[model samples]
Target: MAFVQLLVTSLLILVTKADVAIDIENASSDVYWIGILANPGLPIPSNGGFVLNGGQTTTVSVPDNWVGRFWARTGCDSGTNTCQTGDCRNGVECAGNGGAPPVTLVEITIKGDGGQDFYDISLVDGFNVKASIQPIDGTGDCSTAECESDVNAACPEQLKDGDYACYSSCAKFNTDQYCCRNELNFHSLMIIISPRVPLKFQMITVV
Candidate 1:
C-alpha cells in the first residue's frame, strides 16, 4: 500500500490579546518534515516555516488577531524548499501562499464570531493525517476537535488516488446534495457522507 505522511495537529489553545505561541511536536520515527504557515491579511509569521526532525519541537509566535492555517510538508529538503507532500515557495518561508489543495489543514481565526476564536480541522480540502486542538488557558465547554483517521483508504472513487490525501466527496461529486446543500437531499446524502470522516470546528471562549 502506498503511504504518505500528512500534517496533523491537536492543539489546546489559550486565547488572549497577548502574542500567541505555537509549539509543533514531531512524532514520526524517521520522517524529516517542516511546518508551513500562511496568513491572510497579516504579516508572515516569524516561524513562517521551519524544519523539525523526529521528536523535535519548534515554536512560533504570532499576534493575537492573526488568522491563518498551518500544514506540514513531509520528506522535504530544507535546502531546496521542495516537499514530497506540502511544498511551498522554493524556500523555507511560505511567502504568504497557501498549500496545494487536498492537503490536510489546521485553520484558525482569532476574535471571530462574537469575539470568540475559531479553530477547525478541515477535511473539506482533503483528509490525510489526524488533527485536534485543546484550549490550554480558557473556560468553556469548547470540545476538542480532531480528525485522525486516514480517509484515503476508503476515498470515494472519483476522489481517490490522490498523493496521500482524500478529497471531499462534495468537491469531487459536486451534486445537488454535496454542492447545493439542499435539505431535501440531506437524508439520501447521509449514506454517501457517513463513511467519510467529518470535519470539526471549535470555538474557544477566553475567560
Candidate 2:
C-alpha cells in the first residue's frame, strides 16, 4: 500500500472587503464538492461556477506501520509578471495594459479511510489556508503511533501588495500504503472576468 497527498489553490480579487460570493455551478457524479469564499470581503455576483469530479474512487487499504497526510492552498489569478495577460486579471477596470485583481486563498483537508470526507474551510494566515488530519475517536487508523507535527503543515502568507506567494509541504510516511483506500483528489479553478477575458473560467480536475 502507498500514501497519497493532494494540494489545490485558487485566486481572485475582491472589489471591497464586504461582499464575497461564489456560485457552485456543477460537480462530478461520484464525488462531493463544495464552494469556499475567503477573506470575508464583499460578496460578488454569483456568476455560476462548478467543481468537477475527478472520476476516481476514494477508498483503499494501507500497510502496517504506514501513515500519511495531504494539504493544499488555492486562489490567485496569476503571478506578477504574467498576470496581466490571462484570467488572473479578473476583468477589472484598469487604466494600464496589465489590469489584475487581488489574490485570495483557501485550505482543504481529509484524514484516514476514504469514505466521503469533508475538509472545512478555515482562516489560517490572512485569507491563506491550513489543513490537517487527526485521530478520529482518539484512534486514527495506523499500525504505529503517530504525532501531529509529523503531518504536513505548510501554510503560506501574503507577500507585498503586488507579489504572488506559494507555500506548500507534506509529511513523510513510515511505510508504503494503498493510495486507493480513502483517497481524495483535487480540482482547482480560476474565474477571470474583464472586458478582455469576458468571463473566461478555467478549471483543472485531478484525483
Q: Top TM-score: which candidate number?
A: 1
Task: Look at candidate 1 and tell me the lDDT of residue 109.
Answer: 67
lDDT of 1: 0.56
Candidate 2 residue-wise lDDT, 1-207, digit = tens: 122222223111111111211112111232222222211221211221122243422222222222221112123122331221112222221112211222222222223246322222221111122222222322234222111121112222222222232211111111112111123223332322224423222221111
Local accuracy by lDDT, each model: 0.56, 0.22
Q: Model 1 off-target regions past 4 Å?
A: 1-17, 30-32, 78-80, 170-207
Compared with the true structure, what per-residue lDDT tens digits does model 1 show for residues 1-207?
011112364222233346766666666664534444645457566446666667675666677776777776665675666766556655666665656555667776666667777676666555555666555545455566567665656666677635566666554566666543566443433223234656332222211
Q: Any idea what lDDT model 2 has?
A: 0.22
